[model samples]
Target chain A: MENTQPATAGRQDPTALPIGILAIAGMTVFAAVFLMAESEAAVGGLLAFAAVAVLGAGKLGLLERVRAAFRDHELTMHTAIVIGALAIAWVFREDHFALLMLTMAMLYLTACLGLNVQLGYTGILNFAGSSFLGVGCYTAAVLTQHTAIPPLVILPLGGLMATIVGSVLILPVLRTRGHYAAVVTIAFAVLFKTFLEVNDSLGGPQGLAVGEMTLFGWGFNSNIEIGDFYASFYMNYFLLALVITILAFALTRRIERSWVGLNMDAVRIDELAASCFGINLARWKITAFMLGNFMIGTAGALLGMILGFIAPTNFTFADSLILLSIVLLGGMGSVWGIALASAIIVMLPEKLQLIQEYRFLLFAALVILVLRFRPNGLLPRADRIYFPGWRPR
Target chain B: MSEAILDCKGVTRRFGGLVALDTLDLQMPRGAILGLIGPNGSGKTTFFNVLTGIYGFSDGAAAFDGRDITAYSSQEVYRAGIARTFQRSRMCLPLSVFDNIMVGNHKRLDHGLWANVFARKKLRKAFEESYEEAHELVKIFDPPLAERMFEPVAGFPMIDRRRIEICRALISHPKLLLLDEPSAGMTHEETRQLMDDILEVRDRIKDLSIIIIEHEMGVIERITDRCIVLNFGRKIAEGTYQDVANDREVQEAYLGAE
Candidate 1:
């Protein structure tokens, strides 16, 4: 199904909780953590958030409009960043907490976007997404850490590297098809893990540690002061993550509604019939796989930046399955579904800390129940999400 | 006389060692209804599959509108003005009845991602024109169906599903329409109305040609400009209704057969 923004009044239904409220709540919590924290960097983070929060809430009527404008996943899923930022403000408004949360949120958003491309639009049960993300992480990590190039150049290069590697893995396997396709992709992820553990040039099992990512003149290693907090290179790098995430989000959304998206849906609906429509089945299938993997690579880069470390164990098939579960629980064929699924998958374990290892089991069971009850997703997409152009009824 | 619109020469096809078609040659003149009749296991369906490129032929080449298309895919063949209905009713189940027909208009979509999003200038223009055309076709073909355009096609019963299938295929305004067992599960009156609709389609596109496959003699006699009979990949008879019906060989073939 395609998205057609319902009328304004319909969107602003009084019964439904406004999306902005969540954003505001997230900010308030971040502010408390930021202002009262002991770290000098924490104070600056708090001020940055306070400034952003004031702007966000100052125009209450506009904020309401913004809430109404929440179309898809950007609503609930992006809320994690707001919440995380607010939390950072609450505990330690110093250092790069606000920046870190934003960057982390951006990376998560990119991952969600990537997963949506595979699971939402294409109907592919890709369980190798995280492995590709690892590819990006490793690529960016090695280039920026080992070489002299700026991270700006390395990030896109990292995405390209992962895309090339992922395409080589995914394109040829498309002919194998169905549950078999997923199995092969998962096998590829495991293979990547094996390669990482054995290979020496990529730092072997311990993986590569990131080096400094100095921008043109901005020495990321330098520290700055804003209000009561101190800022460092980590904070700037985190902001960089937000930049990449926004770009990824826009691009993914565009492709989701484009001809590629529609044709991909056609593939999901019926391969034989779609083939009869002059659509090249092989090319589109490969392209979708590659594009999805490209975003995963970006996510991987962000993940690498956040931790400044990488290892073979990080890119396991389990991570891929977790991502798949997120997409499934959120919705198949929905951008928002991917976002919501990511937020839940990332946040739920923290909230249900007592469940410990059983959290995954609980999620798995919940996914099954959701599938049984709402076969489509939490927000089922429009089935005939057709472009009412060029073709007569 | 209308010019021959479809030509097949030395179109040979085989299933392993089994011959599905043996040097089969046929010509369908423009604006004519061609009937294909055969017993079970005959090559009628095989020929349809071959012409539509569902299965590659074992040998030979073909041309349509002065272009060789024997090597093209089914979709390519469709783009070159060929449309067909499935014997089992292959209408898109999830799409709306109208949307199924809109598929026929796929060749017409011009906008990429951005244009499709906002229905930008060129795409919006195309959308408006196409929607109008789909609406007009629905009104002319089945007035009642025109109103039910937004309903899911899967829910339609046997008759309406077939009708929607025909509507979808015809929406492309093909030069050649291939209907495989259009009346397979229909009542007599339903079959009659379907035939009438087929005639209306022919009239609407005067240059259009239809190669219809059927076992029913009544339908063959009523709609065909000429008929071809096959038995086990071999052509047994080719003639008009009276000519083929009166043939002694034809009488023998149909003896005690419905």
Candidate 2:
């Protein structure tokens, strides 16, 4: 054991270990400070610490190595950041803004991953993504309010309901191509919103109150404390969101490397070629639409349950655009990129509330800039080989 | 003569006022290379599209291996042992060569969503086998290409893309392979090499029939066992390559002789 430890330690860069630990410590401290501080000052302190770290690392000549590691293990770094932020929040009991934004980011990530399956992998234009999210939210809300079903049961059921709606829409939606299909989705979103507003049984324009969700008799609406770390309702929701997010991420990554993902890609690149290869075009299209909506619906249900309310305004065409922008800005089909994009979309406005009114304009400009420079996204998907000996030596 | 594998009877396709394929009847015996020659608008591609079920035929029927497939969808036709290459190569450029080829074998894959997620051990085994199969097919088809199986299609030359398309079609183990202008953009030497490869592939794969659409008369004459000529969306002549070339109607269709 002693000999093996020395040999393994020799293989890993000695500096990498300490630097990683230091970086984690620094990030944790900075996050704790940011969570406890006022919004405007928190952003400043966070940026200052980040700048200092970058500059210090550069001065120490460790920046290049750090950058290389970050580049190679970008997902690991992002995951670490998320875990650190949540851990800080949980320990400190900072449930007001940090936990809220973190929960929002997770929900957004789930929704964007759903969109990524359609627009990124399947090449389907779905402007009705928000409508699916709304479907999920409303399903959960209506069920919790009217029925005696548990939240756990209603969550998957919400996804099923959204899938049904998405599948039914696919017939007309798939008939159109490219921009035309996008138009169809946009119209569908509008139709869905109007329908929600008009239906009195669905609470019409006023919306409905969602009952507190319980899982195995443990109410998520209430707070529980661990030995050292206390959990608020937001923290409970945050932990639940985190669990769901990780599962969704794992599932998505698996699908991306599987035949199912390959077929979706084939369908996206060339429908004619995909069909010629014996890929069921309609089935795949329907699958992409329905599965994507399923994820979105799940997120929607979770969001509604956590918020304890639902309204037609929550699922708007504007919200759909924002979700799509998250996918695009994150580098279409890139999981980590989408997560980063969602984080920015969810947290940036709150951090820079001084320019809250101009947040959309800033986001638009940032998107335009990113498109101009990195049109493929912040992290365009690289060629992943399925078989051995396919990589360049 | 071998058994007729692909039979099209009065298969007609109309695009509103214009007929793309007019009462087209074609039959291909197993282990035969039949060349389809035509003018620009003579519907050589249209016939391929119709048989492959890309475009719905307005009339008549198409059968593969004695089974009626006129109403079959494109993917259904493929599952029924028919695969085709496009005139303009349709490659998934962003995808790895291995994935592009593996996608051709998708019909045989275990693609249950829940199964893929939950059944890791079985799925991994299936994936490894599929990957190995793709590699083996590429190695047998083009030994040199076996090394570059992971490279994206975007970096590949047009000829390489064409070869990869052929390899993809072959991986599916289709009984009838359709080559729609496979030599459209190739030089004479390249076309000759492609012809040799096609002939070699035919020799290797037993009972495989090919219907090649070509504008190059040399390709038609050298590669095809028999030639069918089309003009104005109708068959003008059908015979041996030499016979079709010498036919007055075929000559007029190409040269516009008075």
Candidate 3:
């Protein structure tokens, strides 16, 4: 038999770089227009256009071609995406509300990426994602109020605090499976809220005020004045959140593409098979749980600092469901899907006031529609490629 | 016997009041293919479970490669150079062929989180090596299948999936490979092909002992160097295939004596 290799093997598509850059530019323009739209009709029209464009791409089989191009030129595509995201801030430099919303979306994206590690990648169901975020927020709130430590220093410290608390929660979580495990997390979520509400030292139901994030004498809470050009203070928070989100996204992708991801997938699919193949089931589960909690905690800490105050109400069970919806709606285990889902989940309600009051219902309806039509998610996770420059034929 | 890779003394496994595997004494020499055959519910798989540490020994001990592995966990057993394929074909169907095989290569891969994330060049080098190893192993089974290395296993047929499962077990380069009903859900022709593939694997991978639990007498007769027959959770006969085929107890257990 002749030795046959895939035609595209080990070769970079010449069009990939240009296509990737164009895609990013297109997305950035759409985001800017969507953000600047004042009338509800304009916002709805843009949403419809996006929906139609995505559907048309799928129908024309262009989605796969775009995906292949992105995969072939990952570094280029990723850099373009980062630049495009940063350009959005530049476009809306004076729009405080847009910057604030953008920052919130990035923070939520970070938290959802963490949750994806456990729920999507590891098959560990965690319904109390907001509780871990609360752990981080509360940790930051307390540390900033009582200590002389810098808020930037307290950022990762809040993540550590959540990981420590998550370790305790995982004890019960580890003992259960499927819905039982979800129940354990749910109980923890309720318990955490009650603990915060009843504990006076932690400010009870009124919540606590968190100090501003400062790095080397630059307060993130202050507006920027660049010689006749004025930008909202939220831009500072947006930039920081963007950095954290990018790091989280990159780390999540690395984990998903490596050997650790293979082991986690093995564990997720079949514990018996994973164990027999030398994967420590408990170790992977704990690793995923702790890592996820740390990401959520850090994002929450930053969110607290961004908001300047965080009450128990901000991290309620309903809030957690919204995070879960983003993961489910985005397509489990797909980072790109999660990023898109978070953006839509965060921006949709705010953009259209008519659906803001019934946001939960809207989310439920959207999730139901997606699950019914596209169960694997809007953009399901693609196959893992071990070697660079190799695509499955 | 002294050079055996797997030696078990009084290996027993009991579930509630029923003894699934009675005090079974078994020895498999290095580089030998041992066939474990028995009627359904006669403890053939139960014995495998005990030996591989999937099920704890009720009242016995097992040693593999000169180490006491009686108390080892399944993961520890695998790390100690023992790998296995499941009876029901437990392939992570969503995973690519390379990914499935790499699951068994976990013992060889650097699993440190920081290393996987920060050490890109090192990780890439490791992945390239693994891909080559897995590709070569798959090529031994089917040259065509080797070309589709990154394709998901879900799209493969039963024989190819079985081949992939065997390749997964072989990727770790184990001292012993446990195949539980490899022929299940496969046609007779596919089984014959798989048996040839297994023989090819044993030849390519030096000194690799294999313990296969098969119901097909022809398969046991053709491939296995030695045969162990079980009846009522006890070893009824053990010897060459002809010896066990001629044993009165083995005959009685299979055909029901008048």
Using TM-score, give the best candidate's number: 3
**lDDT of each residue in B1-258, candidate 3, tens digit only:** 459999999988999999999989999899999999988999998887887788998998998989999999998999999999889989999998889999989899999999998898999989888888899899999999998888889999999999999999999999999999999999999999999989988888899999999999999999989999998899989999999999999988998998
Which runs in model 2 stand beyond 4 Å of their true positions? A1-86, A90-92, A198-201, A226-231, A385-393
Cα error, candidate 1, residue B16 (Å): 2.5
Ten contiguous residues with the weakest lDDT in model 1 chain A: A1-10
lDDT per residue for candidate 2 within A125-202, as digits (tens), equals 899888998998899998998899988888888888889888767878778888888898899899999999999999
Write the candidate numbers in order of decreasing DockQ: 3, 2, 1
| Clash pairs detected, candidate 2 | none
- Judging by DockQ against the true structure, name the best candidate: 3
Candidate 1 per-residue C-alpha lDDT over A1-393 given as tens digits, one digit per residue, 9 for 90 to 100: 112343211233342235545655564565445434655455556657666765766454444344443532334645665455445533442446445544554576687677777767666777788888899889878887777777767777777888898777665467688888878887888899999999999989888887555577765545656687776556666656656766776676656545556566667767776666656677667767777787888778757866788888888987787778777777876665665566456644543445557987888887899899987776555534333212233
Interface RMSD of structure candidate 1 (Å): 4.0
Candidate 2 DockQ score?
0.43
Cα lDDT of model 1 by residue, B150-228, tens digit: 6678777888888888877887778888989999999999898889888986887879889999988899999999998
Each candidate's number of clashing pairs is 24, 0, 0
Cα lDDT tens digits for candidate 3, A1-393: 111324335555565567557767888999999999999999999999998987886676556556766777777788888899889999999999999999999999999999999989899888889998998888888888899898887889989999999899777877888789899899989999999999999999999999889888998888999799899999999989988999999889899989888888998999988999889988899999999999999999998898889999998999999999999999999999999999999999999999999999999999999999988787898887655465433
DockQ of 3: 0.72
Per-prediction DockQ: 0.32, 0.43, 0.72
Answer with 2 or 3, whichever has the higher lDDT: 3
lDDT of 2: 0.81
TM-score of chain B of 3: 0.98
